[model samples]
Target chain A: MASQTRQWLLTNPPVADIKLSGDDATFSLVTKELPPVGPNQALVKTLYLSNDPAQRTWIQKDQDPERLYLPPVQKDTPMKAFGICEVVQSEAENLKKGDLVLTEANWTEYSVQDAAALRPVQPDPEHGIKPTHFLGSLGFTGMTAYWGLVDVVRTTASDTVVVSGAAGATGSMVVQIAKHLVGCKRIIGIAGSDEKCRWVESLGADTCINYKSKSFKEDLIKATEGYVEVYYDNVGGEILDLMLTRMKRHGRIAACGAISNYNNGNEKQISNWNEVIFNRIEIRGLIVLDAMPKMGEIMETLSKGVKDGKIKMTEESETIVKSKFEDIPSTWMMLFQGGNQGKLITQLV
Target chain B: MASQTRQWLLTNPPVADIKLSGDDATFSLVTKELPPVGPNQALVKTLYLSNDPAQRTWIQKDQDPERLYLPPVQKDTPMKAFGICEVVQSEAENLKKGDLVLTEANWTEYSVQDAAALRPVQPDPEHGIKPTHFLGSLGFTGMTAYWGLVDVVRTTASDTVVVSGAAGATGSMVVQIAKHLVGCKRIIGIAGSDEKCRWVESLGADTCINYKSKSFKEDLIKATEGYVEVYYDNVGGEILDLMLTRMKRHGRIAACGAISNYNNGNEKQISNWNEVIFNRIEIRGLIVLDAMPKMGEIMETLSKGVKDGKIKMTEESETIVKSKFEDIPSTWMMLFQGGNQGKLITQLV
Candidate 1:
């Protein structure tokens, strides 16, 4: 049975002198017969997709050359992302037809992937969760928070944790995971606005400070009382420097992402590294892809937490004009402008 | 009998414009009658004093202007140091006269100190170690190596350990301890010359590289084979930069001391910190004074190792003339120039 699949492809790749604008970019949906699944592969139908800031990082032609986190996306290729899918056809042993799965599927209606890349999503009927929950809370973002706090940072109950980009998916998970699992004494969430700050506090943070406010540093210090032991940094730049000053002795900083400096061509350099010597701080940069082996452990912990009502998960939804998968480029552009929040996904059914 | 004691004092302090030379910069030996020991205090006759690079850092006016470590040496006060002392008189319950002890005794022939600051030395009859060993391998330097490797660096037996300043007192002990107790598979020692490299290899390093060689970086790469897992950094600056580039993922760097840039009025700044993020390295700065509480555990390990002949210990001795005590300023000046190896001491007997 031949099946038709539609994928959004980039055309007229941006060059060095070109600026990223609608006039210079195009998104096209190509309809083709679905390819046969290999011996250890499955055919998955896309359900919910994740639009992340990391995607914008790769879309820019002139991103920071010093970015050690993600590799630069090649020209004119299908963009990569995590999406919730249903296994429509399968040749693999573990996955059967109609099995809900999560995988690094392309920005397409249908994807045929190796069984190694696909994780079977066992639906939890008891938690009253949706398939979208697998794309947000029980997904890459949640796992990133778990590994960054537990494995990389080694945060303890006595620690005071401060997280940047606190309203976003990974940052939100970081705040909750640190508070609930690690039993962090104090959690100060730094977000762009007061509404996000309030939302972060709703997730059980001790305090939440608006980074957009003029008194962000003062507020952070007041909230943490000059005792920040673990800094889960998602947005770097001046905020990073500010947090470094307030770090206690033997503090651990997990440099998860530098979203503030990601779009800028030049990287921000820390001026006072002598403080690193004086305070004896340990700073580490991490990538979730590098943390893939611990996926099983992270899932077990997060699933239990979700079931016990310890980890509260939420998503922000935005309705955008949908075309035949050809409007993904425009949808992604809106995301970069902060037009969407939480998990940005387009409904295909 | 009341004893008459003489001690060297920094009589004139260095102001911003004042040169460290000439009559204004004076060291005076004052003959004074000893004061009576109070309860919980002991009068000790200083035997061997330990002169370290960190002492120079304490004298600088600009280094940590707030005096995070300790206040700058006051004019006309006895210089501070760690020394092996013989108890002349004791009013404390734990100590008695004729007992050899180790304490933070000043650079003097005789001084009074609290018994709480002193640890009674138990002579190990099997090893036949000297009293000076308490100031070197079995004392502060030895304990420094123990904590930095085990606790700070968290070295494992499978690690490939690299020690910078490997021929120095603490560095030598670090090499031996990592090789014997930690059971490191490969130990590479970096020293100043071929002779020092040979000395490090003799002390049980699998390989040793001369940092002074023109092709030192190439030699280091060839020697270690790009497999440095734990770097015990005693000398920072360019050597540190070199080590950072080759560090394996999750490598631990024990920033024990930066002897290379310690006395540079303008300290050298590290440029290639991107390697820190790229390799996901953890660099921890350490002070041996902070490791004092673990003295008992450290001694237990060292005593057993020394008794079993698993640890080889050596001390570098450079003796200054007794009259040169007045030239204390110049004597300390020589240390910044790397004029002495192992330990530099002034003889008064």
Candidate 2:
């Protein structure tokens, strides 16, 4: 057994703009004795960690617990993430040694967690599904995109749906779900790069525009035909402001994420706000954990869709970063730097 | 009969700011001979004009007619407003001389409109409902307040509603309705002055905060206790931004008006916008004209409430501007300048 466990701790207050020089000042790498397995608990070794934009929200400084859907990571504590772990020692009947499971763990090499809290990943070897599918398609990423489009806005075949962050995991899931499962009349995507836009279009989106392009505004206007009925907003900021102005009457916005605004307290401003009144728009913020009550129902629908060949979990564009245990902060910084594509995963093993 | 009638014309492209010096450069007062009443038309004398903040939205330049719930007033044309007009001559059987009616008449001494477009005001002497009530409570102003509360967010008695512009027409109306009609549990009001705050409380708001106060942020925090369930926003600016941070789970915003942003393009920015996602907020925009299909139903309910003395159309504090014929631009500008209180009305007669 390893005598010591290495973990990352947040030393400074939260800020998304990471200067690797100053970044080391924000997070600390420390060594601790491996926690002993106790009653109803299992000691596990983390194999992989999911890299996501929402991580920025979890460590927000001084955020009220009542206001946040997720509990904010406190200062000077271990950084939080969902990790695929292998149970090495178990004190519970359901959790056996060598069993692979998914659980919320810290930025540590080893964690002793409640065995009952672990979710057993059921990989479909026949369907070419890997264990990472639990962290990508069938995980928080897929559930968010599925329910956000279905429950948040109820995208229908009669409606035209536009998705921001269309090249990323949640955004790409939303595009595919709206196209294949919901069968929307027109599905448009907004991505950061031309290659990302093309990739989004290839995923059955009717059209995808590069927001980085000089003609993005004009291109979006032409593509939407001045009618954006449903917008699954993964990137908030200037894109959200522009969408507000062009929304058709009774427009619906599914605020899944605000990746653009998740940087160093530099959140963007929405000035064309009065258009909300003029167009009778509806903007609803979505958090996947809030959909827990409907977990079984939505998961059944998702599984059925996948089994029926209606939806693809995600393509093979997953950006998996293999990093040393001490390089956790740098691995996380890449999510904010736009240096990743699709679902960014860190192979902790 | 008066040989000629004076009317205010939009000489320049629309902008919300009205400097009496440069303002006159935007509006031109001209005299024109009365048009003969054609078949199906009635020539009427303007009685009372509703000087509203929404009038600013009507004259916005380069606005797409398809995007606006109300048609944007074009340049080189008479400015548009709802008014109490007395029929002077009628060529249609439903209309007659001396009959008081309501209409979307221009800023003119006289308007020749289709008799079918005129809504006869049924003033109830027993209840003291005057002909102006149609322009105040029973008209667009009252309907906006009533439906914006009833339909926009479906505010219930269990909800705590905070209203902005609590001293203005639609705002005060929202306060009264949320309290008396909707019977909300805790009603909070946001106003420009301590005096306006007091007036809002007098209208049955449980607490009213002056946004201009030095401790406005602390005051709002103390009042809400970080549990704002719903916000009826009429003044959209910094106040709206502040309210966003304290919203409780599943918070709803009735986007009725943005009086603060209706200036010379000095719209305030919302920085802590991620709170929407954190709190799972739902924001919906409202336009009174969009409720036309539900007009008769809502109007009937409003009239019943007034007949039952449950809701006040408005207190006697209606700011009636008895302006001289040429000073139409100055009178209309008072709505934007906060120079008048309550529902600012221009007594054209």
Candidate 3:
């Protein structure tokens, strides 16, 4: 029997606030017939979709095409999504039918993508890592934390690191790597809720501050003992400003993401450049693509770490909100409000 | 007859505003008998004193003593000053009487310092470098410009550069070095007045913006043609914010000084961290001492550049407000208000 495919297209991009009722005109759901796989192509059935803060920036309008590191999402196009998939049919020599893979299949039930775009995700059954773990702990999010902390900031065991968005996917891994793997002297986590703070502490953070609380500033000063040597910033805004105030001389900041300001047209004003100058801080914007060439070695090390119990990842057991394929838009919106914990993903059969 | 030494002490530190009338009690003048030079010490007569923006930071009442790269100024001690001097008495084999030197000699007519602290300033008469030029373009100020532009920022001829405080001592040298010596594609200067702008243009800046002008923002946007690859900032405040808006991806900034926000307790808030993140800008604070190990090679190159007419310095014929030894307080006050130009100094004979 011929296969049927379903896809969602961004009809109207969200400008101010993101809505996710499935009734909103933000996305249009449509059913269609699956096309045949051509030469060097594979028919991929989406399994697990990944949602990230960068999605907000990819939808921003009036961007300088030259400045944007990623291509902007266009209206009427299938919104881009990264996910784990199962190859249903293939006309390529490198991939065979029934092979598990990772690729950008968009918000689609089934996608006919070039075989070159898919990465084989054959997890060692002996190691007991789920295929979806390939999308979270062993994928781009894990690499983001690795390259940011180890390659970019070059954090040392003696350094005190402050991780903003500490409860989020990339930030949670950063906290663990800084504490358990890198042996940082102290790790402080800045998150939004009391529960998130507790989760961050469980990930081995020395202390976690709920930024939503009124006493966060006083608490941060007391927690870090008035000194911070490395700041792993994933949420850039006022919290980044506060971090700047207590940075030690020659402090290094790994500018990984700006999730806090991504949804508001990125107009958040930071008013602590004086501190950056006086403290001799170095804030380097991190684009994971720059570290892609070295990923094979990084992934090998990460896989070994998982087997050795050196890298303890929280995404496997906590906070992953499971949803149906039809709920992609709603699941994505949860990322903006921190409603989705761990890595936000939608599973499709 | 024994020689008497005169010096100025910070009897009452300036907390709010700096006044120089000698009656404000911020400084006290006293005369005392000169002590004999000890072994390895040289008794030097002060010539030309360098008034810098960093001096204002040294006297702050509440400073993290460990963070300060330099020792803070104490209430009863002589104010720290760098100047050209003539070694009158030398007990160390490295120095001799009447030899010209450059060293830190407080606000004093005579200073007995370790001979190792003084670097010989033997400019070949054929080079036509005046004795006072050592305090301006050949001393620490020149080294500041050299390390910041060439070593730290590593600017190339293909880059467009913007310099704030382009008419001042270190800044003017940076402008000349980027344009004339480094061969940058375009050099734009941001200064306080139209006259200073013209002076900066004459110093080889492709264009100059009078930051005090009402149309400064529009003028800056128009001048750069919507792109700036390097920013050599000396006056860090709103000007730094303006530069942030125009910086290109992977832009480099050499944070040399914050003269604009140095006085009045450095309260000027910077609101441009967002730009620093999106543009992938690297702002590095330049502490000249960190570059001291390379001084021999750098000083040699700068001296050769001056001799070969490759480094066209502007201080040869500019506003250098020279005063007597007792006028150090008043001369320093000129720096905050922009009352003096070129290099503000006290010529003590």
lDDT of each: 0.73, 0.83, 0.80
Q: What does candidate 1's lDDT look like per residue over A52-156, in tens digits?
A: 766655545643434445665556667767777888889999989988888877688888889888887777666756677777778778888888888998988
Ranking by TM-score: 2, 3, 1
Please write out the lDDT profile of model 3 over residues B182-285, one tens digit for every residue.
99999999888898888888888999898889999999999978688899999887788778778888888988888766654536355545566666777787
DockQ of 3: 0.30
Comparing 1 and 2 on DockQ, the stronger one: 2
**Where does candidate 2 stray beyond 4 Å?**
A266-268, A313-315, B266-268, B313-315
Which residue pairs of candidate 1 clash? none
At residue A338, give the lDDT of candidate 3. Answer: 74
Pick by TM-score: 1 or 3, better one? 3
Chain A of candidate 2 gets a TM-score of 0.95
Q: Considering only chain B, report the TM-score of model 1.
A: 0.87
Ranking by DockQ: 2, 3, 1
Candidate 1 chain A worst ten-residue window by lDDT? A315-324
Highest DockQ model number: 2
